[model samples]
Target: MMPQSFETFNNIVNSSPVLTDRFSALVQDTISAAREQHGVDLTIEDCTAIAELRNATLGATLDRDELDRQMLELSSLSDSKLKADIAAGDQEAMAVALQKVNAGKEVVHYERSSDDRARRISMARELGIATPPPVQDDLRSRAEKIELLQEVKNPAQRVALARKWGLL
Candidate 1:
């Protein structure tokens, strides 16, 4: 099954979205700790029930201003996740939100095929790596053929472009 939403993570009502890297160990530890402290073994589900009871007494009885502040914090964190095509205003919010995510993450790139041979040769030269000259085709270059076909209108020109660009 899919994981629970992050908004309900460790919630008093549900505990399905455990974000720990070692979830089984965390669950076992919670159960073990509860047994050690209370002299009764408590499963993860039982621990969740206790949390609900704790919220019933503690959260329900908070002072008005404190409750309002706490509710504001909870609402920000527990609101629904963003959609793919967020509204324009939300997109701006997401851009700011992204600034807080994955800063300085490393990225790796792999080499491409010889079709980019000309680009690679220039790059190697700039990096001071000795490189052999590129093997040039006797006929018109690929870019030239593509550029030549841009204004093509006649049916025969399409066939000519196809054959020249080897799309046939």
Candidate 2:
């Protein structure tokens, strides 16, 4: 049985001609490459998974683009705010403005990191690399595992969980 969320996403993609066309092209390419390069006949499930990864990578690209635009806007605004704070000699306001700028930079950094990971995973899938199946553990629900994974800041730990989920 298809998960409800995936069914909904599929319906949304189907509704959009552009998205449907893109997915069809990606699926065909992946299928052909897998057959030729690995002598592997991909199942429908494998094709679907690869398409989903590609979609996610596309989303991350869009997100990064938007973040770049936002950062530019924020930089312009911050420059004006900093100048005003400096002219007014309000050290506290200047500090606050700088902090906000730093926060935005941090957000951009995080988003870029996420986008890099998505791109890597998508590329790996496209190349027909065999990903390990998710490990079976009694302690954590899928949602909990995902939540924990996101909270982890350590690169090694994050990679471990990503691999466990066949995302690396």
Best by TM-score: 2
TM-score of each: 0.21, 0.31
For candidate 2, give the lDDT: 0.55
Candidate 1: give its CA RMSD in angstroms: 18.6
Taking the tens digit of each residue's C-alpha lDDT, what string does model 1 give over 1-168?
223532354543244333333344444655564456334454444433333223433234424354333332332221212212132336554553343232222331235434345554553343223233344555877777667677688879878766755756
Runs in model 1 with CA error above 4 Å? 1-60, 63-88, 103-168
- Kindly provide the TM-score of model 2 when superposed on the true structure, using C-alpha atoms: 0.31
RMSD each, Å:
18.6, 22.3
By how many angstroms RMSD does model 2 differ from the true structure? 22.3
Candidate 2 Cα deviation (angstroms), residue 77: 51
Local lDDT at 130 for model 1: 28
